[model samples]
Target: MSCLFSPIKLREETLANRIVMSPMCQYMAKEDGFATGWHLVHLASRAVGGVGLVLVEATAVEPRGRISDGDLGLWSDNHIKPLERIVKAVHDLGGKIGIQLAHAGRKSESRAGIPVAPSPIPFDEGYRTPHELSEGEIQEIQERFAEAAQRALRAGFDVIEVHAAHGYLISEFLSPAANKRTDRYGGSTENRARFLRETINAVRSVWPKERPLFVRISASDYTLDCMTLEETLRLLGCLKSEAVDVWDISSGGIVPTGLQPVAIGAYPGYQIPYASRIKRELGLITMAVGLISSPELAEYTLQAGNADLIALGRELLRNPYWPLSAASALGEEIPWPKPYERAK
Candidate 1:
């Protein structure tokens, strides 16, 4: 069997394959931040397509933490039922599902609330000038993260990925480019990693020890004078004691000077090197994401020991059946869902 189709045992959860559906924001939630039918269909289809792990989009831990007003939320009990239904659908389809709990920080665009950040940095000229969170508020957000993680448990999610990448709240604190606080969460690498470690600790407190915990982080900010790969490694080294089971590695969402979309590297598996280095150095299971659309590349990445999992966003969106198609393309026989067997 190809490594891409090999099962990976993550704590008590064992994924059927190494192809993961990367968390791509669907901005289709209701204004109140409840999951809608769109999420159910989107996630269920991927499960049916045979993705071993379907990571739901970056779900906001609090209303003010949303990247957009329409982002999924886990702030209240009301949100749990809708998520439970989706989780049940994925489970019924024999696929493991996970959620990416996130806070957008200075990048939040919620009209109903003002965005807050580690420092008072704005993402860009068009973005709002965020309030610098007080120490008390910082701790509260961590509690919110823990509360959301508990909700994930209630909803029957197999995994919970802390969305610390893509210039979100936690990522802002991790990146020196955005975080300018003089407090313990800012100056040195150890200090900068404090908030993320605290947040992870908070989540781990409520999240079951038997279950797996994943942390998604930007390995590099893609700009000079910002957080480097070395800084990221150091930060993760400090938090290794948190018992984080996996690293979902991605890059570059904190550059505020002026982001050039075309300037960022876009080659297939461009981020694999970072994931490989992080996995080797930190001794943690690592997942690589970013432009890895081809099945050959995904399988090759795994075979090369560059990453433990291959996560794709646009590739899966373009074709939910990418996994089944990939199995065929790679000369592997992954069982197709009964309903789609004739088509397969």
Candidate 2:
């Protein structure tokens, strides 16, 4: 059997294969941040298409944390039922499902209210300067993350991934370029990592230890003043006690377009090296993502131990059934949905 088709267990959750549908924002939620039918169909299709694990998009932990007014949220109890529907649909289809809990912070484009960040810096000239988060407010945000994790557990998700990547709230704290605070939450790398460390601890308080917790991080900020691969390693080392089960590695987005790393899609498997190195050095499981589309490439990555799991974003969007086709291409006999078995 191809490595890609092999099952792997993380905590108590055992995925059918190494194929993961990386969370991609749909931007189709109701203004109140409720999941709509579009989200159910979007995520369920991938499960039906045989994705081993389907991850819901970056869901906002609070109203103002939304990337847009239409982003899904878990801030309120009302949001749970709609998300639970999606979870049930995916589980019934025999696929594991996860949700990426996020806070957009300075990157929030939602017209709800002012954005908040570790500093008052704007993401770019076009964006407004985000209000610097007070120490009290920072604690509140961490509580919000914990509250959201409780909602995720109530919704019955198999995994919960914290979105600390791509210049969002937690990412802002990690990047020196975005965080200019002199407080304990800034200055040294250990200081900057404090927010993330505490945030993960908060989530872990509510999220079950038996279930896995994943953290998505931008391994490199692609700018000298921001995080480098070595700095990222230090940051992860600081988080060692959190017991994060997997590091879903991706890079850049700490700075604006020109200042960030070149577009990740410029080369296939462009971000694999970051994941590979993190796994090798830190001895942590990682999910490699970014422009990894072909079955051959995904299979090679697993066979070579580059990453524990292969996460696909745009490729899954282009073909929800990419996993089904990929199994055929690699000569792995994965099961297809009974309705599609005739065609297979």
Candidate 3:
């Protein structure tokens, strides 16, 4: 059997293969961040096409954390129905589904309503400077994450990923550059990591012990004052103690526009070394992401012991069948949908 097609047991959920469909925002949610028919069809088709794991996009733990007004949300019980449908559809097709629970931090852009964050930083020119969340409000937001996680449980999701990267709320708190307060939730690395740790603990408490808990973090700040590889290692080391099953390594996003680096400069698997380092250093399973599209590259990454799981973002977006096609291209027999057997 091809190693890529081998089963991976995360917590109690066993994935059929290592190819994970990274979450990409569709910005097509309804007014309440509820999944529309667009999400249902878009996510389900990938499972039908033969992805081992299809993770839904950055779902907000609160309305204010949405990257846009139309982003998917799990902030309320009402949000569960739409999500349950998506999860059921994916699983019914013999694939596992996970949800990326996120809070877009200072990156929150005004769309359906007012924007808010850990600081009043604006995502870009003309974007509203978000309302810096107060400490009490921060605690409340953690409660919201717990609530959303419970709703995810009700929605029948197999795994829950706390989205801490990509200039989001948790990311904001983690970045010393973004989090500029003298309070308990800011300043030192432990303090900066406090919010994310609390949020993770909150979600994990409600999330079934048998189910896996994943956290996506920027492996490097790619800028000064932002979290670095050393800090990330410390954070990942701490997170492992809290029972985080996988660390999805994707870099950048803490700094403001001028400091951010474009993806072009990084080589294929540019961030794999971070995943490898964390895995070796922290002794935890890690998922390598960022610009990994080809089957050979993905296999090479895994074979090199850089990551235990390979997450494909834009590649999967351009071709939802990338995994199945990759399996075929690599001489591995990936099962096709019964109806699409001849096509496969």
Candidate 4:
């Protein structure tokens, strides 16, 4: 079997292959954050198309944490059944599903209320200045993350990824450019990572040990003043005891637009080096993402030991059945859905 199509075990979850449908927000959820038919169809189609693991989009843990009003949420029990239906659909199609639990923080345009962050900094011009979270409020948000994990467990998701990247609440606290607090949650790298560390512990409190827990983090803020690769390494190293199973490495989104990395899509697998470095140094499983659409590139990345899994975002959105086609392209005879066997 080609490396891209080979099975890999993550904790007790054995993915059928290494092709992951990276979480991309659909921004199609209801105003109350309930999953609708669009979400069900969007995720299930990828399962039918033969993705190894289909991750649901960045779902908010609280109303104010949403990137917009349309983002999926798990802040309430009412959100559970809708997500459970999607999970059932994906499982029925023979694919494992995961959810990205996130908080957009100062980046939130949810209109729910004034967004909150570690500092009162706004994401960019024209964005509202976010409310700085106090110590008690920070702890409360951590509890909300724990509560959300419980909801995810009840929803029957096979994996739960903490979305700590992309200039969100956790990401805000992690980056000095965004975090200007004077408290323990905002000084040295250890202090900056404190929120994420505690958040992981909170989630792990309810999350099963056997099931893998993933954390998606931007390996770099792409600017010197913000989170650098070395900082990322140190930050992740400190979380080793949290028992995080996978580091889904993607870069940027910590800084605002103009100051972000210019080399993001300079080439395919551009972000693989970040994942490779993290995996190599930390001895952790890393998921390489960013423009890894081609079957050959995906296989080469694995063969070269750049990353353990290949995650695709826009590529998967453009072609839900990319994996099946990729399997054929690589000469691996993975099964197709019975209804689509003739095409195979």
Q: Evaluated with lDDT, which candidate comes out highest?
A: 2
Per-prediction TM-score:
0.97, 0.98, 0.95, 0.98
Cα lDDT, all candidates: 0.91, 0.93, 0.84, 0.91
Per-residue lDDT tens digits for candidate 1, residues 136-204, read 999999999999999999999999999999899999998888899998888888888899999999999
lDDT of 1 at 90: 98
Tens-digit per-residue lDDT, 1-344, candidate 4: 79999999977899999999999999999988999999999999999999999999999999999999999999999999999999999999999999999999999999899999999888888799999999999999999999999999999999999999988999999889899988899888889999999999999999999899999999888786568888888888777764698899988887777767544554888889999999898899999999888999999999999899999999988999999899989999888899999887
Model 4 error, position 226 (Å)? 2.0
Q: How many clashes would you count in candidate 3? A: 3
Q: Name the lDDT of candidate 1.
A: 0.91
Candidate 3 C-alpha RMSD relative to the actual structure: 1.8
Error of 3 at 109 (Å): 1.4
Tens-digit lDDT string for candidate 2 (56-170) = 9999999999999989999999999999999999999999999999999999999989999999989999898999999999999999999999999999999999999999999
- Cα lDDT for residue 314, candidate 4: 93
- Model 2 local distance difference test score: 0.93
Model 1 lDDT-worst window of ten: 256-265
Off by over 4 Å in 4: 261-265
Candidate 1's TM-score: 0.97
CA lDDT, candidate 2, residue 210: 91
